[model samples]
Target: MTSFARKVANLLGVAEDRLERLAGGDLSEVLLLRRPDGRCTVAKGGAGIGTEAAMLRSLAGAGAPVPMVEGEHDGVLLLEHVENDELFSPLAWADIGAALRRLHERRGETYGWPVDHRLGTVELDNRQRSDWPGFWAEQRLVATASILDRPWRERVEAVARRMAELVPPDPPPAFLHGDLWSGNILVAGGKLAALIDPACYYGHGEVDLAMLTLFGSPPPEFWEAYGPLEPGWEERRPIYQLFPALVHLRLFGAGYAAMVERLLDQSSRNLSTTE
Candidate 1:
């Protein structure tokens, strides 16, 4: 067993009789821990592991479906093991929609997290900003400048400068699960089971919704149950999507760069129409 698995087992007051190292998609160690009694839990260890623990606590406290943190140590967190029973059904998606809406209702005073964190190994700046558009533009888009090609960088900067005009900025800030993609969404028993790996912050709730639709559109049931979206959300989705696309472009390179380009082009065209 890896030292990480043993450390978590010890922290949780269990023997490491059954420890299975699982596939952690990012820069972390993941393990399934089972005690002699057959009870199971998950252990994660790595940089920023504690940040996720804090997010799970906050999200669970706000009524979002998340695993209970069983124990935590330096860069290691033990979480309640939620068994996956089945994929999401329309009814399950409705539950997810309701849960996310409740989570968003937990508002914050500003548009950033209290501490800096990572979005899949990329350093994310959490410096608070009262203005949402400027916050998104600087923290999310323009932040990618150092990694991008000159042409792409210039285009992105141009859009960032015009972000306030292209995207509506009047929505009140709310709790956001900063990285709410399909992978972070867990389903069991044909229902939404848990939300994991949040890069939590205070922003428009639509930021989470936009990430959900980035790789693929959510089931229509999600929309039906999510209720009416914020005004101008449709017009702003492509712009919100640019944040993750830029993150991916920076992480994985040109394949995702194409996605960033497409989103920026769409946002630019939309800006033209508005003008």
Candidate 2:
């Protein structure tokens, strides 16, 4: 098939030549065409968009508020093209929080995402780890610190090492979207229609909260729902945000470099205060 949607359709058992594409997004294109049942539905296709599709499939009908995937073709994912007004609104953010709260309430005996996916222009790897401190040290904090250069690199490593020791013990291992940014929240009818593009994994539930506030203030209700499920994590937001800031630092350049410095400094301050 010429279009990504068609490719996805063929992968999902639809005829490739008969496939048609409808719209496109940052990571994938959306398609509208006949399902084997002959009903029109949306499909997704592109580099690594399948990861996001797989994520949604795991959460589908779990009632946490996400789209449903019909099938796949090539690298394309056939999904319900949900019509939504906007993924970001006061009410939608609150619902997102509530939805996440319910999601985290489902526990696994581990810490890490089942898979990793990109965050906007950034790539986040969610390899499994036995402990949060080591996970943050090796994967999130230390791993990113290794990529830095000069004084800031040393500075981040020092802060990461210190924070790694001080970060609270493993509270509860729960599924996190791993990247719950404003862009991933979808709203319909002034309500949250779904949580799209999750880098699904099991880890500190608060990791999702940290990411929500990393770029900007997610709706208060979003945190409110998650907070009751796991409280006092707002205190550790900076530590979690450091991972993305580091990713951005590597991807965007000095602008993100400055953010890394600030996050490290903030992490040091938070750790000292709690100590």
Candidate 3:
């Protein structure tokens, strides 16, 4: 083990004889540590790990299924090893829907989290605001504009300007898993074991639902468990989805540019219909 890993193990009061690397996203390094007695723990090390630990604790407090935070020190976060299955059963889909519903029920008085967070190379400007439209416009949309080309930046700015007309002026500020895709979810024993790797904040609940649909659609069982959404959720979905599309464009490169343009066009149509 590296000196940092050894220090983390000592801080968490664990003695691990073996370390195995696990799949991780762009921002973090994940590893599984096993003791001679068969006990196991997962350690994630990178920037913002402590913040991830706090987010997990917050979600767990709100009755959402998440890995228990064992300890956090320096830049390392220790977590309980959660078993996950690659295949998601219908029961798991429904369970995730229900879990997400419960998570969104935990409301906040304002939009955004107390501290800013990062997604890939972009810093999420989570400065709390009372106005949802303003939050979405300035913090979510316009914040990404700096890294985009002039044309794309102009398009984003135009949408940001119309945020008040596009989104609700003041929806209930529901807690959100700011990054909610299939990959972040874990299933075991035909149920949702945990929602991991969160970039959490308080925002429109539809933001999460939109992100859930970004890569693919959830099953009908999911919607049935989640219940009906607000009437205009479909139209607002593109607006919410645009942020992640932009993030992907920035992170993965130009292949996602078409996805961004498509979502932008959809968002424009939504504006036209509203007008």
Candidate 4:
């Protein structure tokens, strides 16, 4: 911990005896600190940690449960420490799906935040257009293409330009957990308890469901629970899933590169054959 870390601790009212460091991501360091009264706070210190802090604050009490943000210190943030270990079970999947459905059901005119925000490491601008296809093409696929390798970039661009016609314009837009992979959800007592790391925006509800299914659908129960609001989703699931594959390719490395390329090629073939 550095002077900056200490200052952040002071801001959270936690003293030396109370603080214990928790492993954090590459950019931030997290400390779980107990106060004199035994109350606990999760202090996160680093640059850009503020986005998650701000998002949690803005989306607080939007109906679903999440860590209640207490304070944001210059480059750090304090949140009510959720005291559960990582969700590591099959049942946890169902609970998370149910919780996600509840969140997606949240009604709003426009999905993205009014101001600029980051989705984990990626910058998000849901402020563009309410048109989901346009957003995916311009902001998501195209915006990230600059960093992708040449062959992969061209393939993604080709698929993206025609994505408007491939992805149907049905299923009225619902709030999406933009990045709802298995990792971002939290579970406790065998129940999905909270949502974290939102890249929230509005789009076809299937986008969230499709993402959940991307890394292998959470579990049978999860799909069953979500099936009511979203029935018969398999038809377009493959198409919707391309977004996450592309995201992984960009974020991780060449390992995901092949996966993205494969999906893009398949999508192009499917579109072309149909035409």
C-alpha lDDT score of every prediction, in listed order: 0.83, 0.70, 0.88, 0.68
**Lowest summed lDDT over 10 consecutive residues: which window, candidate 1?**
18-27
TM-score of each: 0.91, 0.78, 0.93, 0.84
TM-score for candidate 4: 0.84
Name the lDDT value of residue 27 in candidate 4.
Answer: 35
Off by over 4 Å in 2: 1-24, 27-43, 46-50, 87-89, 114-125, 148-152, 223-232
- In order of listing, the candidates' clash counts read 1, 11, 0, 1
Please identify model 3 stretches exceeding 4 Å from their true place: 1-17
* lDDT for each residue of candidate 3 in 1-275, tens digit (9 for 90 to 100): 67656766666676644567777656666778876677788888777887888899999999998989988778888888888986788888999899899999999999999988898678999999899999998898888877788999999999899999889999989999999999899999989998899999999999999999999998999999998899989989999999999998888899998899999999999889877
List of clashing residue pairs for candidate 3: none
lDDT per residue as tens, model 4, 127-166: 7456667766777777766566787678778878887767
Q: Give the poorly placed runs of model 1, Cα more than 4 Å off.
A: 1-17
Find the candidate with the highest lDDT and give its number.
3
Best by TM-score: 3
lDDT per residue (tens digit) for residues 1-275 in model 2: 45554445446665665556553355455667665675677666556767877777677645577777766656666667666676477677777777888888777787777666665555566777678787776666666656567776777677767755556667678777776777777787657787776777877877787787787787676667546644456667778888877777776678886677787777787777867
lDDT (tens digit, per residue) of candidate 1 on 151-184 = 9889889888898897667577889988898778
Residue 129 error for model 3, in Å?
0.9
* Least accurate 10 contiguous residues by lDDT in model 2: 1-10
Candidates 3 and 4: which is better by TM-score?
3
